[model samples]
Target: MKGFKEFLLRGNVVELAVAVVIGAAFTNLVNTFVKGVINPIVGAFGTKDLASYTSCLKGPCETGPAGEVTSGVLILWGSVLSAALQFLITALVVYFVLIVPMNRMAARRKSLAEEAVEAEAKEVKLLTEIRDALVAPLR
Candidate 1:
């Protein structure tokens, strides 16, 4: 029980849980965008809904009133295209908004840490020189 509590409180676990929740929400937002904005834009060329776009794999592919495949094989290329678009958009946004910024921040922190180390080394060297000079004169 104690270990379980500790595990739940661990930084990685908490971060992962938050990420899952946020990812789910983000997926919905991207889906909505694709359906509402992208589909309509593409609709200007053909159908308004991307999912409705299909290629008949077999002869005389038919759909029911609700668009369910009633007979024959159908390659739902439009749905695939829509999913691909959503994936691309999600990847682009995550890369630019999250990964890029985090990488920049990490680089900045590394540079600052290196600078501090260099400064400390210089200070130590200067102090050593001063101590050596004073001691040599006394000896």
Candidate 2:
């Protein structure tokens, strides 16, 4: 129980939970955008629904009243295309909004840490020189 409480309270655990919720919400927004905006744009060429676009691989391809495939093989290329577009949009947004900024911040922190180390090393060297000079005069 104690271990479980600790794990739940951990910074990363809470962050991960928040990230998951945000990601799910983002996914819905992307899906809605693709369906509302992208589909209509593509629909100008043909059907409004991308999933309705299909290639019949065999003879006598048929669909029921509900658009279910009744017979023959169908390559749902449009649905695949829609999914691909969604994935691309998600990846692009995540890369730019999250990954890029995080990488830049990490680089900044690393440079700052290096500068601190360099400054400390210089200070130590100067102190050593001063100590040596004082000892040489005493001898």
Top candidate when judged by TM-score against the true structure:
1
Q: Per-residue alpha-carbon lDDT of model 1 for 36-110, expressed as tens digits?
A: 999999999999999888888768998899978899999989999999999999999999999999999999999
RMSD of candidate 2 to the true fold? 1.7
List where candidate 2 sits over 4 angstroms from the true fold. none
Q: Give the per-residue lDDT of model 2 (tens digit) for 52-120.
A: 888898788998999888999989899999999999999999999999999999999999999999999
Off by over 4 Å in 1: 64-67
In model 2, the Cα lDDT at residue 47 comes to 94
Highest lDDT among the candidates is held by which one?
Answer: 2
TM-score of every prediction relative to native: 0.90, 0.88
lDDT (0 to 1) per candidate? 0.94, 0.95
- Residue pairs in collision within model 2: none
TM-score of 2: 0.88
Residue pairs in candidate 1 whose N, alpha carbon or C atoms collide under 3 angstroms: none
